[model samples]
Target chain A: MVEIRMRVNGVSESLDVPPWVSLLDVLREHLGLTGTKRGCDQGACGACTVLVDGERINACLALAVQYTGRDITTIEGVAGGGDPHPLQTAFIRDDGFQCGYCTSGQICSAIGMLAEHGAGSASAVTEHVAATGIALSGAEIRERMSGNLCRCGAYNGIVRAIQDVAESPR
Target chain B: MRPFAYVSAPDVATAVRAIGTEPGAKFIGGGTNLVDLMREGVERPGTVIDITALPLTGVEELPGGGVRIGALVRNAHLAAHRLIRNRYPLLSQAILTGASAQLRNMATAGGNLLQRTRCPYFYDGAAACNKREPGSGCDAMDGFNRNHGVLGVSDSCIATHPSDMCVALAALDAIVEVESVRGVRRVPMAEFHRLPGDTPHLETTLAADELVTAVELPALPVAATSRYRKVRDRASYAFALVSVAAALEVDDGTVTAVRLALGGVAAKPWRAYEAERILLGAPATEESFRRAAAAELAPATGRPQNAFKIELARRTLVETLRQLLTEGSAA
Candidate 1:
């Protein structure tokens, strides 16, 4: 077992985990932070999406030992000051999910996507990649959030919820 | 996943030494591909050397107006780097088109180059795949092979290289820099990956002990106008059924310079040298573009399900060149 230290949801935690234990397994099994769901253990489904140092990645693909000393933010961490994140409220208002299995990942992925867009990152659908300040169009949101899949096919509402949060003045 | 001893390398020398000393050891970058394959039982490394801590994550400007991208640079970071987006937009575009945003965030440049094919046979333990176990028959040859390669295929295997980023790198004439205890060697991007030939298991030129240090994109002015077009089952988050990476420079309606590479068609990124030869000094017209694409694809062979890839590749290449032409004229 390897001793791993990481900051999860603003809490510094240390644990001894096997080398092959995935970050998703560590979060769900060890730390009991089960909000980060595991849809496809592979990287195909974004149900295990989490933020490591503010960048979104699939927890299912990351080894727990490889993320030592990094800041990890999961769906459970999105809420701030004892209140649901605005995107979470928007998800509820827009009915952004048919089943709740993918909700946590969608919310976490959206937060990272918003941060990336704010940093002027270009998506596959972006017309001019070199342009500054990417416009958060619906197409751009869909393209950016394509990593996360909704088996219930609630993409319309998910896109709507994300668009609401993106258009709203933070 | 099988249990393995893990060692986080503090530097390049330690990482190389760890892999060089242990025959069962493998280097882990982002663990996006290696971990997945490990879970699938396709990759069983007794020891995993984590090299993410190595100081090889910079995107530096070379002295010759080119760019040297560190091997550990994450795909998302490389795609978003200001120099990459402005100077090598095709590379940026290609990186964005592959996998998904989450995968890209964790996948590194070196890891992307070394990623294995997504062929179902290769992943399925029950299926026979020479790449998985040499001397084993290839199931993809007669199985559901709609996604298999059409060029540079051997009877032993028909798996297509599943990277969009490498296709652009090949077109830009990038050089892969690798190092080991033996010494450092530079391999041109076009020659980095190997053809299936008789040994489908041997994928790249790098030995097991070598670590990819960096990828150098040589100064190529044509890359500025280049574009990558990937035709997949969906518009977003799908591997290419056929893809084209091309840069064209026309001088007074005559093609002066051209670079063409194809994806989802071969064991390696198929650089269309025949098509490039035809396009150079030829009229930059639809007729010439189609002729060149045909000449390059004349030797291509495809199975029943994947036969469409030949025409798809030709059309995609012609269309990409035409789009570049239009963009060039507009500029």
Candidate 2:
């Protein structure tokens, strides 16, 4: 067993996890933070999406031991204590989910996508690839969110929810 | 996933020593590919050396008009770096057209180059695959070989190298820097990946104890106007059925310089040296482009299922060159 310490959702947590255990299992099974779903347990499906050092990644593929001392933010971390994040509120207000199996991953991925856009990441469809940050258009959101698939086909609502939060005034 | 002992290596030398000592040891970077294969029972390493803490995550400019990219640099950071986007846009575009944003964030530059092929037969243990086994027969030769390969097939295996980033690197004439207990060495990207000759299991020239440190891209002013074209089943999050990375420099309507590479076409990133030969000093026109593309596919032999790839690759090359020729569009 490998012992690892990490800050999850702003809480210090230590555990003796199997070397084979993925970060997804550590978050869901060890910490009881089951918000990160395990649809594929592979990198292909983003159902286990979470933020590692403020960047989005597939939790199912990352080894728990590899994430020692790193800052991890799961769906639970999206809403601090009791208040829901603006993304979460927008997702709820827009009814952005159908079956909701991929809701947590979608929300986390959207949060990462926003941060990436804010940092001036460009998508394939962006006209000017040099622009630090491009306007979050519908195409931009869809292209960026392609990692998280919704078999329920609730992409319209998901896009609307993200767009609403993006255009909202701070 | 199989149970394995994990140790985080502090440096490249320690990592190399650890792997050299343990017969079943393998380096894990980001664990995107290794974990997936391990879960599938394909990769069964008894000791996984975590290399995340290794001091190899910097991207700096070299003295000779080139850039040195650390092996541990995440795909997202490399693609979004200002220098990459402004100078080597082809490299940036090639990486961006690759895996999803999340995968890109976790995937490392070195790991992406060493990623295994997505051949269905290779993934299925029940099927025959020379790559998975030396003497085993190849199932994709006649069984659903649509995505197999059109070049570098030797009846042993017909898998294509499934990396968009490597395709661009091949065109850019990048160099791979690897180190081991023996010594450090630099390998040109063109010779890094081996063809599916008799030994399909030996994919690269990397020694068992060697660890990739960085990749260096030599300055090619022609790469500034280069572009990557990937035609896949979907607009995003899909592997390319046929892709082209082309960079052309024309002087007075005659092609002065060109770099061409093809992915999803061969066992390795098929650098179009033959095509470049035909296009160099030739008039940049439809006929010249077609002739050059045809020359590259002259040695190609395809199965009935994958026969369409030849035409698709032809059209992809033609269209990519046409866009570069006329400055019409970008994919």
Best by TM-score: 1
Q: C-alpha displacement of B163 in model 1, angstroms? A: 0.6
The local lDDT score (0 to 100) that residue B261 gets in candidate 2 is 95
Error (Å) of candidate 1 at residue B104 is 0.6
User: What's the residue-level lDDT of B168 in candidate 1?
Assistant: 92
Point to the candidate with the largest lDDT: 1
Regions of model 2 farther than 4 Å from truth: B328-331
Where's the lowest-lDDT run of ten residues in candidate 1 chain A? A125-134
* lDDT of each residue in B152-264, candidate 1, tens digit only: 99999999899999999999989999999888999999779999998999999989899999999999888877888999998999889999989888889999999999999
iRMSD (1 decimal) for each model: 2.4, 2.2
The residue-by-residue lDDT of candidate 2 on B1-331, one tens digit each, is: 6788888899888999999999978999978888988988878899999899998999998887799999999999999988788778778888988999999999999999899999988888888888987798998888988887899888788898999999999999999999999989999999899998888988998988899999999988888778888988889998888899999889898999999999899989999999999999999999999999999988888999887888888889989999888772232
lDDT of 1 by residue, A48-166 (tens): 99999999999999999999999999988989999999999999999999988999999999999999999999988887777787789999999999999999999999999999999
TM-score, each model?
Answer: 0.99, 0.98
